[model samples]
Target: MLVLDLVATLVFGVSGGLTAVRLRLDVVGVLALATLTGLGGGWIRDVLIGVTPPAGLADWRYLTAPMIGGLVTFFLHPQLDRINATISVVDAFGLGLFSVAGALKAVEHGLGPLPSTLLGLTTGVGGGVLRDIVIGVIPTVLRKGELYAIPAVAGAGVAVLGSRLELTTPVVAAVAASVTTGWRLLALWRGWTAPEPVRAAAAP
Candidate 1:
């Protein structure tokens, strides 16, 4: 589980750095975005639980994960620049993995259904929100329409519910994550977005 967390963090960090590069940010800006996106969710979770030092600071791996991700982006900027589609694919996988991990950990800590699910959503989307804010764009979650948080909520719910049903943890997590990832990617490919309401004209 720890290894999975680290890998997902690195993946998100790389994608975040890629976003920064696309925005034409400087080196410092790029690293900053990567690190923040990598650690923001864990940091938020730790702070919420009053965990001293926060997981991001206590674990060297957490700090190093984003740095490595940033380095990857730095060195592979040219390749990544021409591969926007690749980034989206990788980002979806990262999102699903992290959502499962976050929800699982939250349940382990004794949170109930709603709170645990909320934590999962936060974990999945928090970093991306921070990354976007750093680069001066609205977070995807807050935008007109995106399937991001919806799928995360679905994945988290599945994991938590499966645990309550006494299923194996690893299997539950994997299934939930896979489902979430599949749904998100399909939505993206099909341009599935929330419908905008039609407004009535003002009374004459």
Candidate 2:
């Protein structure tokens, strides 16, 4: 579980750093994005549960991970830019892992199903939201199409249900994360989308 958490943080930090490079942000912006992506979800989760200061703020390892991510990206931007698909793959994996982790942690903390699932979504999507907001764009989760938060919710739901079925925690986490990542990749490859909202008729 500790390894999974670190991997998720690294992946998210890399994704955020890549986005910052695309936006031509300065080093500060890049570092900020990496930090936010690496720490934002857990920070939010802890805060909501009344954990003061948050683990990320208190833990040097978490803080250092994103710094390393930012430095790697800063030096490798040109090479990484040539392979945007690679970044997408990493981001998808991070999303799945974080979502499952968040859901499991929430349940461990005695949260109910709905809130647990929501926390999972927030964990999966929160970093990207912060990254996009930094770059002044609406989040991809709110846009017309994208697997994004939908897969997070689905993944978390599966994990939570499995928990109730007495499945081993590791097995549930693995299955949920794998399914979410698969769904996201398939959505990207095939352009899957949810139905768009139908606007109500204008006053007439």
Best by lDDT: 2
> Per-residue lDDT for 1-204 in model 2, tens only?
677677778778887888888888899988899999888888888788777788888988888887788878988988877887877887788889988888887888899999999988888888788788878899878887776888889999888988878799999999999888889988888999977659865777
Question: Per-residue lDDT tens digits of candidate 1, residues 26-145?
Answer: 888778888889888777776775667887778898899987888889889888778878777877877788777788878888888887788888888889888887767889777766
State how far residue 5 of model 1 sits from its true place (Å).
2.8
User: By TM-score, who's the top model here?
Assistant: 2
Please give each candidate's TM-score. Answer: 0.89, 0.91
lDDT of each: 0.83, 0.85
- What lDDT is obtained when candidate 1 is compared to the true structure? 0.83
Clashing pairs in 1: none
Regions of model 1 farther than 4 Å from truth: 195-204
Runs of candidate 2 with Cα error greater than 4 angstroms are: 199-204
Task: Indicate the worst ten consecutive residues by lDDT in candidate 2.
Answer: 194-203
In terms of lDDT, the poorest run of 10 residues in model 1 is 194-203
